[model samples]
Structures are given as C-alpha cells and as structure tokens.
Target chain A: MEDQKPTSILVLDDEPIVCKRLKSALEKRGYEVEIFFRSSDAFKRITERNFDIVITDLKMEGLDGMAFLTEVKKRSPATEVIVITGFATMETAKESFQKGVFDFLAKPFKLGEIQDAVERAEKKIKGNIS
Target chain B: MRILVALDTNRYSQYVVNEVAKLAMNTWADVTLLGVESRKPASNGTQPPRNLPIVRKLQEFREEFLGYFKDESVSPYAIKRWGYELVDRGKGLLEEMCVCKGMKDFRVRIRFGQPTKQILTEAVEEQSDLIVVGCSKGEQCTWEQDRNAPEKIVKAAPCSVLVVKEEKKPTKIVCCLDHDSVSQESLELINQMVTLHQTDLALVGLTESEHLREEVDQKMKQILQYYTAQKIKAWVSVVDVSLLDKFIADTAEKGLIALWMGHKSLIGKFFSQDRVGKLVRSAQSSVLILR
Candidate 1:
C-alpha cells in the first residue's frame, strides 16, 4: 500500500449501463475505474492524463472507437488498450492490432474475460511479460 | 462507479472528503480527488507570495535547470515548467486529504483554470458517474441571491451530480419523483444510490391540486409496486405544492433529497426548476440529483 502504484482504468462505451456495470465490477476488484459514455469526453481525458489500461467499445455514434484507439496510441504508446464490440470481424481485429491494441474481446463477453485480459495487461505493465 | 470529489479551501471541505471516503468504503467505488487552482490572488492577501520559492530555486539551480532542458525546444520547455509547478501545487493540497485509510488507491487531478469549467471538463473526460461538490451552510446566503458555479454545473453536467450541503449522517433518502417524467431507467438509478448509501428510500409526489389526484395516485402506486417487488422497502406519499418546502426541510433534518434529471416541463405542472434549485441550496442535508 505504501509503495505500490495504483492501476487506473478508463472504460468508454455508448451504453450507459455498460459503463455502469463494468465500473462497479472493476472497482470491487481493487481497481480504480472511470467511465465515459461518449468518445469526445474520453478524448479530452486522454489528453489531460494517462490511464494504465483503456477498454473501449468499437461501435459508437461520433468519433468511433477505432479512431479513439488510434488517437490513444498516438498520445501514449505504452498505455494498453483493449477493444470490445458487438460486431467483430477479422478486418476490424487486424486493424486494431495494427493500431497497437493489447487484446481484443468480442461483445456479450463475460466479466471474467475482461478481468483475464486486464490481468494480462497488468503483467505487461509490471514488466513481468510482454 | 468512478466518482470525482472536488475540494476547496473551505473549513468544511475535509468533512466532505471523509464522508465520501465512507461512501466508497461501502459501495466499492473509487474516487478521484480534484482541486482547481485559480490564477486569482487570494482575496485577503494574507498568505505569503507564491512565486518566491520557485523563482528562488530557479536562481540557485539556473545552470542545472538550463542544462537539463538545453536539448529541448525553448518554447515547449517553458510551458512544461510552468504547468508542472502549478500541477504539483494542486497535487500537494489534494494529497493532504487522501490520508484516510479508504483513500489509499485514489487518483489526483489538478486543473488550473475556472473551477466550473475545469470540473466539467474533468467529469466529461473521466466519464465520471458522479461529481460530489461540497458547500458549507454559511455560504448559502451568499450563493442564494446569485446562481453559484456549482448550481450552474449541476444544470449542465453530463452525469449525475451530488451536492453535499453539510456534515449530516443521513438516515433516509427522500426521493422526489415527477409523476409525468418518471421512467424505469431513473428508478433503477434511484435504487442503486439508495442501496449504496444503505439508507431508507421514500418516494414523494408533488401535485398542485386534487383535480389530478387520481392520476398522481395511480403513478405512485405503480412505483411502489415495482420497488417492492425488487425487495427494496419503499414508501410513497403525495403532497401539495404549498407543503413542499416544509416537507423538504423535515426530510433534511435526517435524510438526503434525491431527484431525477428531466426537462423542467416534465416535472409536472406543480414543480419548477427554480424550486428544485432552491431545495438544493436550502437543504440542511446532502442532495443527490440523478441524471
């Protein structure tokens, strides 16, 4: 507690309920969480500060999630971003990799799956794995 | 939920922080401590000059400071230096309040600009679920005559805003429901906060006259039925417009006031935004406005 740095997560999804449920779940697991239902707001946040991990949904109204991934990687290359979407395709997944996504999870995925991806990202942050 | 707790230099500011810590402990919510640094000089001009230390330090380490940044562009280095100092000062203040045991894993954000604008931008950036702004009882008189920044932020906030008026151990939450605008989504939120606070939930419906009593009655009954089935012990009441102030005051003595966000017209003909604003200002207890 005295020396360890806190890991913070930012979740961006158009669905308010998705942000809400994910936030509560992550917080309960001893992770700091922030949620944005809009990409524009998320972009502002990314400019102001950096988060340890970012979980974003691909399909959105304005400033699509794929564009967000690009912007985030450009701003902070080391920051890990995971893509989650209902409509997943090889093309989108390949593009996400090209933009530097840590992991890609499909929509209707379980909280357990997110936690697993986050754990892997945490290991990467700790320099335990690449 | 990701919650942002904004602090000021007010006497009661720490109380707000402590109360929020207690809330996080119960609900498993992480908090972001935000402090705004205004360029304006202190009103009383009693404190020591702020530029002394940084300027004096720069003089002593002029060679080292210049050497470190010698390779960087002159323009960007100067901007980073100033921004770093300001942000560092803001972090010092926020860190003082993060001493609580529950705040061990908190995040600090320091913004140098207008308080409302900074807060709104941070809230939007964080996509925060709640923004908890603290106000003292003594400052109410001054803010009542004019719409304060907190009031303005509440109106335009993209998420729910909780205005904690003073230090009060809330025993119940008086949820003011607009019969015309009540929806399942809002009710679900009301349920979450009520559960988070571990406080009793009471629904109060405002009506102007008996002409629409039957309609109001049916709506109240439906709300009660839904909440009851959810296993939440809830109560409902119908009150006239004239008695709203008294009802609010009575509730404030031992509980918080919960209201939903909606267009002013959707709040039934009897209630108005002005009255809601007044309720937030004058309430002795904290007010949680759900969006």
Candidate 2:
C-alpha cells in the first residue's frame, strides 16, 4: 500500500466536523486528503496546489458553492468537482449542470454513497494517468 | 414515428442531420429533412424571393445528402423539403409529417430556433420525450447570455435533453453522487439511461470525512445492487479533490460522461462548474449533464 501512489483529494465545507470526518475517512483509504472550511481558503489552496477531485458544499456564509465553482474552473480547468448542498431543488440542479458540475449531492448524505463517488473519481484519475 | 432533421447548412447541423438519420433508420421511423432558409427580406420588401426557387435548391441538396444514405442502403423513404416560413412553416411541416407517417410512439423535430424560447415552446407543444441539440462550436458563450439554447433546453424542457457535440457518442456514463437522498433519484435516472444506451457506468464520490467513508461504501453497495438488478455492469470509485481530474480523464477516454446535476457538496458544486464545463468544452468525449 505504501509503495502505491496515494490519490489526493480536497474537501471544502463550512462545517469543521464535516471536514474532519471526510479527511479521516479518505486518509483511511490511502488517500492524501486536505480540508478547508471556507470557500475562499479552499480556493486559495486550490490555486496553489493541484488536486484530483474537489468536493464542496453548495451554500455557505461568504462565498457560495456556485461562485467557488466558477473560480475553480478558472483556476484549474481539469479538476473534477462534486457539489453537495443542503438545499436541493430542481432549479439548483439544472443550474449546476448548466455551470458544468461533475455531480450533485444533497446534505444529510450517507458515507457509503460518498465512497462510491470517490471510487469513481479514483478510477477516472488513474485512467487519465495511465 | 416522424423524425425531422432540420438543417441550416452549418457543419454541426450537418452532423446532427446524419446522426438523426441514423437513429431514424435504426428505429425504422419516417424521416423528413427540412431546411429553413433564413434569407433577409429585400431592403425594399420586394416579393421576398419566391419560395419555389429556394425550395428547389434545398431539395436538390437534400437529395444529394440522402443519396449517400441510399448508396449505403439506408433509403429514407421520402425526399427532402424546404420552406421560407420560419417557425410556423417548420411546425406545420412537423405536424403534417407526424400525421402522414402515422406516428404513434414518438416523433422527432429538428430546427434552428431563435435558440431558447422558440425551441422550448416547440418542445412543450410536441410533448417530446427527448430533444437532441447541438452545442455551438468554437464560440465563447455563457449560460446567462443571449438565450443559451443548451442550458435553457435542459432547464425548461419537460423531458430529457441530450446536448450533442460534433462527432460525439454516448458510450461511457459517469454518475457523480454525494451519498445523499437527492443523489438517489439522479442515480436511478443515470442507471436507466446507461442501461438503455448499453454504456458503461462509473459511480464517483468524494471523501471528506473518515466517518463518512463507511456510509459511502454502503451507498456504493446499494448502487451496485441496483445496477445488478438491472443487469447493468458498473464500477464505483471514491476520490477526494486531489484525484478528480485523473478520474475524469480516464473515464472520458472510453466515450462520453454523464453526470448527475444536483449533488450539494462543496466539491459537488466545484465539479459542476470547472470539471464538467471543461469536459463539455474540450474533452474528446461527449458529456451528458442530467438534472
């Protein structure tokens, strides 16, 4: 496991507990993970570093998920983003797709579901690499 | 069913025509090739060029185009027709074809609209099950600007919308989920679409917390079960942001990627914008963004 190249992921959410939980879960799976509680901070880190996938929450205090997604696309054109929101609506879903989101997830989610999403991301990333 | 392949003589339009024709042939549906002549009226409003001449020329081109299909042994059973009227003429032709073809299951109409409103109205009126549209090639346009056709169609259409890129195929389908309730509906829809298309399915998730990993895994199991019941093959992968691009590049290599529209996570939102947009604009494969 150590010899294998660890896949890296970035998780951005306003909740500290959510970040911590995600970081721990991903690290257990042999992924190098980073967490950010604010969209601005997350954007700063994203600009400075390259990540394979970015998971962000839709609604936040300062910079919402939609605005952050715009910035991420501007900064890293190749990174795949999966959006999670507590407020899910048909309009928001359509808007997210129009904006070109990779996937959409609503809040109060299951851990297993997130794992499936990561599995897909890892497969996609590895496929590109090899 | 009546299938309309509307043409404006653009390269992408030609491609769409070919694809629609192929679909029509396979489905054994009646096909109509209609070309809309968007000629500006004479400055003095002289008898705006007789419809006969324009129709004749368009008919000739249509025959020539269809001739290739005939040579390939896919006769369209009908000749191509054109008219000078814009939406009204197009709609009339469509309705006429529907009745003439004795269509009972489905009817397809393809025409260039003012982009948004006209197309949306036509789609609603026809009660279409699916609308196939071409994305503008080599142009910079925002979703908010100038009646963005693809965006508007996806949002306003009562049914599914497939935004076709030039020479694109729907082969690889990627479902982005957040292990949430909303994603369940999106997953079901993705499963149905992928199965119908006989495409490969990939489930993607982002891991933000250690506690959630088990939950993510359980959800993956459920998805696997769903696909298994449908006799559809699928693979699931979980990655954090660091590995997202590599995942996309890999899955896209096979064909197109289909993503669920509303997954509400920070990463989900990011994927919606940067990753999905990049793929749609430049990825070698086509993308289906489902809402």
Tell me the DockQ of each model, to 2 decimals.
0.04, 0.01
Query: In CAPRI terms, where does candidate 1 land?
Result: incorrect
lDDT of 1 by residue, B92-174 (tens): 45222222222112465556667788889998887666788876553362321223656666776776777877776678878
TM-scores of all predicted structures: 0.53, 0.45
What Cα-based lDDT does every candidate model obtain? Answer: 0.66, 0.56
After TM-score superposition, what is the CA distance of residue B81 in candidate 2 from its true location, in Å?
20
Error (Å) of candidate 1 at residue A117 is: 7.8
Give the poorly placed runs of model 2, Cα more than 4 Å off.
Answer: A1-130, B1-8, B22-99, B102-113, B136-148, B155-157, B168-171, B178-199, B206-222, B241-246, B262-279
- In order, what are the TM-scores of chain A for the candidates? 0.93, 0.89
Candidate 1 chain B: worst-modelled 10 consecutive residues by lDDT = B75-84
Once fitted onto the true fold, the runs of candidate 1 whose alpha carbons sit more than 4 angstroms away are A1-130, B40-105, B138-147, B182-189, B211-222, B263-271
Choose the strongest candidate by DockQ. 1
